[model samples]
Target: MDLKSSTVLITGGSSGIGLEIAKQLLEKGAKVIVTGRDRAKLDEAKAKHPKLEVIQSDVADSKQVETLKQAITSKYPETNIVINNAGIMRKINMHENRALEDVTREIEINLMGPVRMTQAFLPHLKTKPEAAIVNVSSGLAFVPFAISPVYSATKAGLHSFTQALRIQLKGTNVRAIELAPPGTDTPLFTGDEFTKEDTAGPKPMPVDELARAFVRGLERDVEEIRPGVSNGLKWLSRIAPDFAVNMLGKSAQNMRH
Candidate 1:
């Protein structure tokens, strides 16, 4: 719970929300190790924050996940916090032709990636005095976003998994926390990641604002940290599931039309 002397590992920490979370953690005196798939982006992140210990690893690969687990456990034995923040999104048109492997890339990274990472690190995390597993889900987890069908499905699955994980780990030293963030102005949803038309929704929460809310949630030991519109979406989904899904789908109708 106390980040002052904690050692943390964040996957896909080179850019976007992951990078922001890593920076805020460093300021709180936590030893942060960031892993990513790209060497250049990792280098850029390290250049910005000299305190970061950058490792190149893809969470989507089982071999690489094992290697990362071994490396972190062996090298940074003090690591008590693991953040499963590595994820990707796209505005996919399912009607278009594509390989099955390519069609399910989001599931591999967003859902299975966190599941594998948590399983690999659970033993090590339990050995600590206090530990935490943070999974970054999405606001879309509450209701399907029509344009990114696969991406939304993965997030919904992750949300359910995190809930079950928390129940299983009850009375344990390790805590499972889910961060369901609304659109944040990150590379994940910005630039060429989505077409200009695909981004037609509520303005994204500022990255710094989201980071602040996240740190506060950790300190307060909040189990689910849903920032900005994410909180509203969850409430709406619970009260009016059909209305919520249809409203969100309206924003994505452009993709089909």
Candidate 2:
């Protein structure tokens, strides 16, 4: 709740939405540490924001998660917030012959990464006076994006996990918060995998705005922060699930043709 006093660790903070959040949190006077798999990107992020403490750690690897927990607990024991924002999205044509390991890559990082990170650091967080675990899911979680099936499923899974986690930690110091962001103008969204036609609907929310929403939600103690179209997606899914699916499935139709 008190951003100025809290020390936050964000996974995949090198760029995109994660980097924006790190920047905003730093501006708010929060001690921020960011992790990413790429050393060069981490260095670049550090160069841009001298205040950010960057660590090269891949969230997909269980071993790396354990090492990260040890490193953080030893060096920055005051870390009371963990933001699981590390994720990858790919446009996979499932009809093509792909390796089994390749198809499920998003699951490891987007879903299981948070699960492991929470299990590893929850005890440490619980010992603190106050703490929070912010899981960055997506609007796709509310309604499946057929174009990026694996990525969509992972976010959906994360949404479910965060809800259960919030209930389990009902009387604890740590709060489970789910940040379901809509399509954002990030490298991840505009990457090589997605073409212009694939994301031709509403303009993606700016990454900085999403980060601001995250801070505001945290300050207000909002358990679920759905910014921009994400809020609409959730309600639409409830009101007209089939229509929501058909609307999003248009991209898949384009891919098929």
Candidate 3:
């Protein structure tokens, strides 16, 4: 879909990929609204990009998402695009003793958040002649990461849900797209456990490059946009599923402290 002159809402737009996408959309002359849970970070992002409309809302909170939906629809009824980019990833040892609620946090934020947001915005999006829903998944969705099993599972679930949503939306004005990104240079991977030595090989693609790839994919109407190593993971999973899973398992084992 043409991005220029369109209104777009991006969750988790305070930093990383979401922020990059917001910047690009603004440059493209689109009305951009960004949401983040942290008020300070949202303010910082707004300060950096004066054109950005920042909203403080936690995707994991149902009430907050409902409020966000009502606020956005009331203020920008013409909003035609929703980017489900809010998510959290944590490296956890399943064998370790941890609170049950703590262990499933990724599932709630990464998986359920998009589902909730989509349900809240689908009707509004359908009202527009042209609309899109971009769900940000991960390469780990194709192959499990043993160190972050919960995170991987959540991404996999998201991928599945996006596929189903796309099919269900057939013949509708709304379009569903999934962006599966490879390992990237973001704060999410800044922990000591994710040192350079832990990476399988070369460094990840630049965040800016990945964001550009996303826009290109969307413009081309690609259903799944797998940038960088993500494409390799998808192919490898098909050609050698067991081997790919084993490889990731080995990498996680080495990284575990």
Candidate 4:
């Protein structure tokens, strides 16, 4: 769908890929509203782009998502695009002693967040003449990252969910698109426990370049926009699923402390 003149809501748009996407969309003449959990970060993002509408909401919380849906729909009735970009990732050693809740955080934010947001916004999106839902999954969705098993699993689930959503939304105004990003230079990968070596394959994609690729993909109507190593991962998963899994497992072995 043409991005110009579209009203877009991007979750976790305060920084990283989401922020980059918002910046590009604004440049493309789209009305952009960005949501984040931190009010300070949201304010900072707004400071950078005065035209950006910043909302403080946690995608992981179902109640907050409901409230966010109502607030956005009421104020920005023209909103026709929803980008489920808010997510969290952790490098957890499953064998280590850890709180149960901590182990599944990726599921809550990475997987369920988009699922709930889609449910909350699909009805409104369908009302528009043309609308789109972009879910930012990961290349790991096709092959498990052994070091980040849960994160990979959640992304895999999200990939499946997006495919189903696309099929279900067939014949409707809303179009579901999945963006399976390769490792990107974002805080999600630079967290305390993570290092360059910890990443399963190559260095992260530059955030700006990745964002540009996404916009181009959307303009071209690509259903699954897998950039860089992500595209390779998709192909590898299809032709050499076992080898791909083994290679990723070896990468995790290299990451072991």
Candidate 5:
């Protein structure tokens, strides 16, 4: 888990947390490749960090996922770290009429995207002397956020998948690490999803702080890295599940009105 010598590929790396992680990793001397669907954003990221290898691909697309795997693995044989960080979030009112496909978009990108990428890149990762797969989940995975029902569900499933993946990869060179982050000061929240009430609470962890914690976890070869309040959410989910849900539901109630 020495990131200094690892070549890493991070999906959704054009903005927010992913971009921050890539920048930090690059500073640590890791070869970093960043992928996103937006050509402009990818270009912007490349402009910011000249060392970044940019790939324009969407994890939600099976064909593109395969193409990315083939391209990166062949191009950077030293690639031993894959960070499945690509995802999207939306506020949907289930009571309102919506297409089934639209309703399930979060599940497709947030949950299935990682599943696809891991399946595609795992064999290549295993061949290395030491490798790591980091799946970024959310604190909401432990406590469902009623406003972002679909988004929360996907992260929950991803948390479960990471647990099982670790067990399956036991005694192997490839280490499965799950990074469950609490509400962070990222574009993912400050964009369309934020409400007055959502922003009224305590400030979230800064992106750089989260990135630093991630590198610390990587250096320690940790199995799970929960930053900021995410650790509290995990404990609350286990000891007081109903209370945690109710507390989260209160925040969602604001969005409902």
Candidate 6:
């Protein structure tokens, strides 16, 4: 709960939301370590934030996660927080021809990565007096984004997993937190797969602002931090399920033409 006294490890910390989170957490006096699959990007992130500790690790790989767990638990024994943020979003047309492995890429990184990380680090986190596991899901978890079906499914799966994990960890020192972000101005959202027309809804939230919101939520001990449109998405999904799904599917209809 005390950000100042926390030593945090964030996956996918080289850029976008994860990087901003690392920056803010460091400013709060927390020792921040970030992991990314790309060495060059990790170096660049370190160059920008001199205080940040960078590690090259891929969450999609089970072996890398095991290595990361050993490295962090051994080196940073005081680590109390782990943020599972490494993920990718793709605009996949399920009907189109694609390799079988390629179709489940998001599942490996976005969903299973956190599951593996949690399993690997749960014991270490439990030993700490104050510990938390934060999963970065998406607003699309509540309402499927037809264009990015796999990405949406992964987030939705993560959201469910976090809920179950929270219940399983009840009465323990560890806290399970979920941060479901809305369309944020990040590389993942504005990447090659998506165009301006696909994201014609509300303007994406600024990454820095989203990070600040995340920090505040953690400080307040909020279990699920849904910023911006994420909260609305959850509400709509429950009350107007059909309309919510249709609204999200509008862009996909255009892609089919």
Residue 191, model 4, lDDT: 60
5 or 6, greater by TM-score: 6
**Number of the candidate with higher TM-score, 3 or 6:** 6
lDDT string for model 2 (61-93, tens) is: 999999999999999999999999999999877
lDDT string, candidate 4, 137-206, tens digits: 9999999988888999999999999999999999998899999999899888866667667764577899
Candidate 4 local lDDT, residue 122: 89
lDDT of 3 by residue, 104-182 (tens): 9998899999999999999999899999999999999999988788999999999999999999999998999999999
Ten contiguous residues minimizing lDDT sum, candidate 3: 190-199
Q: lDDT (CA) for every model shown?
A: 0.93, 0.95, 0.90, 0.92, 0.91, 0.96
Runs with alpha carbons beyond 4 Å of true place in candidate 1: 254-257
Q: Alpha-carbon error at 226 in model 5, in Å?
A: 0.4
The weakest ten consecutive residues by lDDT in model 2 span 248-257
Which candidate number maximizes lDDT? 6
lDDT of candidate model 2 versus the reference: 0.95
Candidate 2 residues lying further than 4 Å off, grouped into runs, are 254-257
The residue-by-residue lDDT of candidate 5 on 74-129, one tens digit each, is 89989999999999987766667889888999988999999999999999998999
Better of 4 and 5 by lDDT: 4
All candidates in order of lDDT, best leading: 6, 2, 1, 4, 5, 3
Looking at model 3, residue 198 earns an lDDT score of: 53
- C-alpha displacement of 87 in model 3, angstroms? 1.1
TM-score of 4: 0.96
lDDT of 1 by residue, 39-131 (tens): 999999999999999999999999999999999999999999999999999878877888988999999999999999999999999999999
